[model samples]
Structure formats: C-alpha cells, structure tokens
Target: MSESGKTNPMDEQTPDAVTEADILIGRIVDGEADEQDRTDFERLADADPLLWRAVATRHQDMASLCDEVDHEIAMATTLELPDFVAPRRAPRWAVALSGWAAVLILAVIWTTMPQSKGIEGLPPARPVQINPDDELTFEQHMQQYLLAPYVMGELDPIVFRVEELPDGRQAIHYVRRIEAFEFLDADEELPVNDKGHLTIDPSELHAPVGPASIAETVH
Candidate 1:
C-alpha cells in the first residue's frame, strides 16, 4: 500500500469500513443521536474520559459562540441614532415684518405692470353683461325651490311624484314633508340588533339611552 515495505493504517481504512463507534460519536456531536445511541456513546466515552471531556468542551464553546452571535444581531437591530436638533424660530415682529414686506413687493409689481387693452390692429373689447336668471335652467330653479325647506332643516321630503306633461316631458313633484327630531344629548348612542333594528324600548323612544346601560347589557 506504500512505497516502503511497512503498511499505513490510514491506507487500510476505507470510507465503507468506518467503525460503529465513529458513527455514534458523529451522531452525538451533530445532536442527531437518540437516547439509546447517547447511552452507547456514554459507555464508549467512559472507556476514554479524555474524548468525552473534549466533546463537552466543544459543545460549550459552540453554545457560547451562538450566544455572542445572537447578542451582536440584537445590538445591530436595535441600534439608535443621535437626537435631532430643533431649528430656531423667528420672532413675532420679524415674521409680521416679512409678511408685510412680501405684500408690499406684490403691490409694487402689480402697480408697475401695464394693463392690456386689445392687440394691435384689433377692435376694442366690449364689456359683456351677464344676467343671473339666464345662467340657470328652469329645472334647476324648480329644484332649488323644492329643496329650500329641506336644506333649512324645517321639513324632510319623502314622496316623489313623477307626472308626464302634455308635450311628452316629465315633471317630478315632492309630495310629503316631515320634521326630523333633533337629539339634545350629543353622547346618546343606540345599539342595533343582528337584523339592523334599534335595540330600544317603545316607551323610551324620546328618552336618550346612557352609556352605563349599554355597558351593563354588553357585560
């Protein structure tokens, strides 16, 4: 097996010829050995106490290294930056003077600018008179009149009646009007059931429900 006459022990040992003790020791080191395997390894280690001490020291070193790595990671994640400095604010008089200065500059620019009349060789522009009534259609005027009461909160429009005109056009009319009750208590709240109906007694229709009653029922 060698150039010399003597044989080498490493040359005689093959990958397939690995001993069971080596396999047991490898499994224990890799944390893959079961209870029976660990027991067998313990017995083998008893034969060589130095080997057991070496393995134990290696395990302790690995655990310490893991803890150090974890500590480094935690420090990196929770790293903090220095506090930011606040900017100095200007005095009240300075701020007011700056505003006034800006206004004066704008005024001076506006006054210095020349007003445009008409382009050269073009006719002079005439002022166009617009009528307020001509701006809105007849339907828009009717809508404003119909919703005036509702907008004022005096009455709410309920029924809408649609009628066909003689010229085949349609006209809508708001028939019913009712006043909505305004609750005095701003903190008054009513709960609704699964069906979306208010969970209130018929006798307590006008009365406001307090938060204590609702909390009691909820608890």
Candidate 2:
C-alpha cells in the first residue's frame, strides 16, 4: 500500500515491470537519469532493498576501473621535445640602423659620465666650444651633434616617395638619396627633380627655427 490509499502499481504490474526497473537502474548507475526519472525510480524502489545494493555495486565497479586507468597513465614516461633554433636575420639597412643606435648610446654615456679622480697621469681635457647664453649642457650638445647626421638627410631609409594616383592607387616616386656632402653645396628650389631623382638643397640643411619658448629660458 502506498501513501495515496491505492495498491502499489509495481505489485500488480506484469513481468515487463522488472525490465523497466532494470533500465531505470542502469540510467541511475551511469549518472544519466533526468529529475523525473530519478523521482519515479526512488518512489518505485522505496520498498526494494535489492535494487539499492545493485546500484552500489555498479558505482564500486566504475570507481575501480577509473583508479586502474589513472595508475596506468601515471606509470607512463614523459614525452621528449625537440631543440628549437631561430630562422630569420635582419635586413642590411636594419642592421646599419641598429649599429647607429648603439653608437648614439655609447656617445651619450661617454659625454654625460663623470671623470674618475682615482686614475693617475691622464692628459688634460680639451676645451669645448659652446654658446655663453645657450641653455643646453655639454652632454646635450654632444647628443645633438651625434644626431645631426640623421637630421642632415644622410641616413634616410625611405629611398622613394609614395604618390597616390588619380585612380585611387599608390605609385612609388623612385628618388635617389641626397648625400650629405652634396646637400651642403647645392642651391635648389626643391630636393627632388622632375624625374623624381633627389637634388641637393642647401636651404633645408639647417635645423628648423621658430619663436623663442619657455624651453629656451635658463633656470
């Protein structure tokens, strides 16, 4: 008798009741039973102790299999990896630029470094030419001098100018590099010629001049 005052359905059911109960028990043991399936199975097996023992046995068997597989994997050796090597080198211009940057760093360090007093028998330092009213320190002036080569258009990497065509495509204006020596001597309206070759222009050699600002004011 059930709590609903009706005879238990399983008590009057046919032999198919055992098969359906077995299927539901398999779903519960495999962890695949839905909420409704689990609820029905609990209610159906309320008076049956043998069905609970079967579920417990199935769970023990699965746990043993999992432990066995884990032990086998743990006993296996670690995988070996191959040695790696770099596969590319920098271009010539990039290498040259790197060398220039190294030189600039070394020059800056040498200029800003304090003289060591512990050294004996060193030659007297040469007098450096600098402006009386200029706000720049000696190290700053040295750095400016070292950077002048790039400022004077001697080490440009852009060998050509990119021009946009009327049809919305870009074209390269292949211009020759204006050597530092040539740029110091020639007088021209523009740096590039009609054929897109570079012509030395003396006027563009100097640093850009503007109205005095707070940066120029001495502390």
Candidate 3:
C-alpha cells in the first residue's frame, strides 16, 4: 500500500468478486465466455495472482480429464471382441428387459449347475490375449464389449417392442447392455407413424438439414 501511496485493489477483494471470478473460470472452462468476458477475466487475474492460479489449476485438471476420455473413445473405435463359440439365442421376448437380464440369468444358472467330474465333459475356456501387434489393449476390448450392441444397431428402437402412450407418444423400452454396464429398464419417448412404427423427421436431426434453413444452402 505504501509503495505507490495507494491501496491495492487485491487487498480489498470482496465475496462478490470471488464468486464472479469463479463464474468466469467456469465459463472459460466450458468455452462459453465471450471476448469481453475473457478481457475482464484477464484484468481480474492481473489484479490477483491467486485467482489466476486457481483458474489455471482447474483448467489443467479438466484438460487432463478430456484427454483421458478421448483416449478411451479412440481405444473403443479400434477394439475387437473376443472370439467365442456361439450359443443358441433364445427367441425374442415380447417385453423389453434391462440389458443384463439375459446375461445375469445365464450366470445364475451356470453357478447353480452341477460340475462335471470328468475334464472332457465341457470344452476349456479359451485364454484371452492382448498382443500389441495383433490384439487390442484390455481397456479397448472392454469398451468393445460394452458398445457392441450400440455400434451394430442392435439397440435401436426397431429391435425392441414399442408401446403407444395415451398422449400419442411412443414408449421404446429396452436394456442396452455394455459389458459390466447395464442400462436397466430404460425407456425413451419417440414419435410414431400411423402404422405405429417409430418415426423421426429428418429435419429434426439437424437445423441445417431442414429444407427451410437458409444457412444450409449458404454453407
């Protein structure tokens, strides 16, 4: 305070200033701040080094998390499922159950079944391998297992029974299981055609895709 014969603004930091700075930091992190907001944030940072440091730390953490997610998605795109002998699939059930329902049922049955005394009674389970030259990483393999149905379009509304609601909305009920993750008893509302099939307007997919959108032609 004595150096310039004036009180420092940083020394008079109020609770409102701290709250505003936090809001600014969140906006910056989310990439929602405007140029003027950025300018004000910088001004505040220059006035208070501690505030700048706090923002920097949070930014770095968020960046690291984003990198990790990107890495997982990259892995998922390249991963392959383990080769296994196909078992007979049961006929499709009329009602949609959670993704893990069938798997959990099988697991329970397998656990309760009597074990064979002879080694030749059942085939030995194949060993899983993940060689970098020919196989995907363990993480990638897991991601593949979890996302296989979604990737293959098996989780589409067409695959599940759709019920009409009293309000003219269609309820799509199904479990989309991905490895250990289970979308349990999940349901979604969808528009339906006169034939009672799920229908989606292409225009609703994207603003630019609509016939009336001028920005689409300009682009």
Candidate 4:
C-alpha cells in the first residue's frame, strides 16, 4: 500500500488499518484521503508513473478488500450468533451457591436475634436441683411448751424416726421430742414401784414354762 515509496505513519493506532502505506495508497484514484494526505498524494502522483500504478493497484486491492469486508459486515449485521449459546445453562452446582447464600443469611439472623426464651417460653429457671437426701434439713420445728401452768401430765416421750446414721448405728432423726413436767399431781404411777413388786414378778410369772425352761429345770 506504499505510494511513491513514502510511508504514512498514522494508521497504526486503529487495529483494522495498521499501515501508513495503506493510507497513502488509499488517497489516490478515489480522492478520499485526508487534507494532509491529499496534498502528499498529489505530489507523489504528479512526479512518478510507477507511483501512480502502484497507488492504482493499492486502491484496487483496497476496493476489493472493502467489498469483501462489506460482505462480511452485511452478514454480521443480518445474522445472529446463535443467541450466545446461553452460557451452557450455568451448571447445577453453580446455581446451588444461592442456596448456600440463603443458609448464611439465615444463620446470621439466628445469631443476631434476641434469645430471652426458647421457641416457646423457656422452662422456669431451675434454681437448684435440691437433692433432698442430705439428711432432711428441717427449717422449723414446733413443739408444745411443756412447762406451762396446768398442762403437765404423764406424757410419754415422743419417738423419732431412726434414720440411717453415718456411723451405721442408725441415729434418730429427732423428728419429735417431748418431755414430762412436774405441774400436775399424779394419783397413780406407772408401776407399784420401780423395785420388783410382786404383782407378777419374773420369778412367779412364767410363760407356762417353755420346753427349754422345763428341760433346764430337769437338768
């Protein structure tokens, strides 16, 4: 595309037209060069026939290329490229990333929401388990005031539950306690006397003498 052996340098910037020779040759025969290239083309076309022929051939080549390019451009303008193939339907695994994103969003909401209760109301706080086996710690115990004015009598000693003790002898739980008082005068006592009075003394009252006792008597 050279004209009169001189080269044009500005065509390098555009990708499709890369040579100054192309531009120089394009100026002749068609009269379509820019103002500056036109002046240069006229100078070269006037001085040399060889330059004119070369420019004509270059012009012819450019026209043929232009027609070929026009045909390609017409086809490109008319034809579509199969709708860009729809990017291959985006692979099933790739679409699943949206699910992962949704899960992350739900997790964030759960982490940030207030937690005053469970899904319903949380069970009332179990202050303590309170095993209740630790020997029954009694907070209070009520007892009759035995030393009152007229109440004292022959009250038997109150019994207690003999709970299991640590030393294994079974200590009493002290669940009840009573005491006798001296306020009331007694008409009768439990026994005739603390000594062996003979209402039914052990020596006199036998259980009809068991066989062992009979045998002992014989022996």
Residue 206 accuracy (lDDT) in model 3 = 26
User: In model 1, which range of ten residues has the least summed lDDT?
Assistant: 97-106
Q: Could you tell me how far off, in angstroms, the CA of residue 111 lies in candidate 2 after the best superposition? A: 27
Quote the positional error of residue 120 for candidate 4 in Å.
60
What's the ranking of the predictions by lDDT, best on top?
A: 3, 2, 1, 4
The true-versus-predicted C-alpha distance at residue 88 of model 4, in Å, is 14
The per-prediction CA RMSD against the true structure, in angstroms, equals: 29.6, 30.2, 20.6, 51.5
Residue-wise C-alpha lDDT for candidate 1, range 1-219, written one tens digit per residue: 211122334436763454455566567767999999989867766766555665665567778988899887875654433212111332221121111011100111222224311111212222334343343332232233223211111233323455566766554443222122212355656555889655643223343245345423432
Off by over 4 Å in 3: 1-18, 70-208, 211-219
Each model's C-alpha lDDT? 0.40, 0.42, 0.43, 0.37
Stretches of model 1 off by over 4 angstroms after superposition: 1-31, 76-219
For all predicted structures, in order, the TM-scores are 0.24, 0.26, 0.29, 0.25
Clashing pairs in 3: 146-178
Off by over 4 Å in 2: 1-18, 75-219
Model 4 vs truth, CA RMSD: 51.5
TM-score of 3: 0.29
Q: Between which residue pairs do clashes occur in model 2?
A: none
Clashes of each: 0, 0, 1, 1
Question: Which of the two candidates, 1 or 2, achieves a greater TM-score against the reference?
Answer: 2
